[model samples]
Target: MLTLYRPGTGWLHRMPAGPKLLLILSVVLVVSLLPAHWSTAAIAALVAIVGYTVSGLGPGLRGIRELGHQMFSLRWIMVITLVSQLIFMGPEPAVANTARVTAAIVLAALLSLTTRVTALLDAIERGLRPLERLGLDAARCALLLTVTISTIPVLGRRAAEVRDAQRARGARNNPQTFVIPFLIVALKHADELGDALTARGVR
Candidate 1:
């Protein structure tokens, strides 16, 4: 699996996963509370940059690149969201919305850069242990998260392949050109993964 995790010994990487998750959540909450303005957006961007630096530059840039790939992969969804905001709230609000979403995404990318997927899965299981009383299977939940994390790069690559193929075939700026192929590839991946898990007695 092409994971966002980068092996490193920086302070950010050394920090416990639970605390890192909490810090990211806190930052998101704080940023969300700020009024939608250039100053607040700039501060959010700075925080994201600090997050990237603390995580280590090379890995952080990789994560950012992965995020950019995902953004382009799901351009149809983004376009729809952008158009809806423009129609309902005008262009200024749409711009602010896009900025806020982008800031949150960059912050998340930075967090994923420093934290390993396995560590994240372990943290999820630990956090959900208390919910076992409610019939939740913490291990299963963790495995699900692990699978989701592992599939991100795969989906991004598949989308890129589809886009390139469509462009070669003279398809232009159409949502179906990308979305249909991406969905098909995603479904195939899920089926293969499910079969592999079953073979391994994942139940």
Candidate 2:
């Protein structure tokens, strides 16, 4: 699996998972509240650069490169969106939205790069512990969160594989080739995961 996590010995990595998660949330809140300005976006990018440096930038950059490659492969969609924005709202709004989205993606990716899946889940469980008074089950919540995060890469890879296979078999660029197989595979994976969870008494 192409995980964004990078094993490191930096201060960010050594910090307790709880605080790291809180930091991510704080960044998100601040970014959301701030006006979408070039200066604010540049600061966010700088923070993401520091995060990348601390966590070892090789893996993170590689992940970003892979994302770029994927986007290039789907260039038509992006081109359509850009052209539509130019025709309707002009280039400035499109550029601002693009910067905002890019900053969010980079910041979140930095969080993943600095924190392991296990640490993330542990932090989540601890954060939810306070909600136990309201009949919330922390363990189950953590497990669900973990499963959901873990499955994203799996589903992504599976969809890519299915798409490639269909393309090789001369399937047209239609909804069925992409969507139907992905849905079927996702459902199958979900069913098997549920069965495994039941067998392990996770519920």
Q: lDDT: which candidate is best?
A: 1
- Segments in model 1 whose C-alpha atoms lie over 4 Å from true places: 33-44, 59-77, 144-158, 164-173, 196-203
The runs of at least 3 residues in candidate 2 whose Cα sits more than 4 Å from the true structure, single-residue gaps closed, are: 1-15, 32-63, 66-114, 151-154, 170-173
The TM-scores, one per candidate, come to 0.70, 0.60
**Would you give me the overall lDDT of model 1?**
0.69
lDDT of 2 by residue, 105-180 (tens): 4555555656787788888998899999999999899878767655654555566667778889999877545777
Evaluate residue 64 in candidate 1 and report its C-alpha lDDT on the 0 to 100 scale: 51
Relative to the unseen true structure, what is the C-alpha lDDT of residue 132 in candidate 2, on a scale of 0 to 100?
100
Residue-level lDDT tens digits of model 1 in 38-148:
576577656656555555545447545545665575455446667888899877666566656655655665466678877887887898899999999998987787676
How many clashes show up in model 2? Answer: 0
Q: Give per-model CA RMSD.
A: 3.8, 5.0
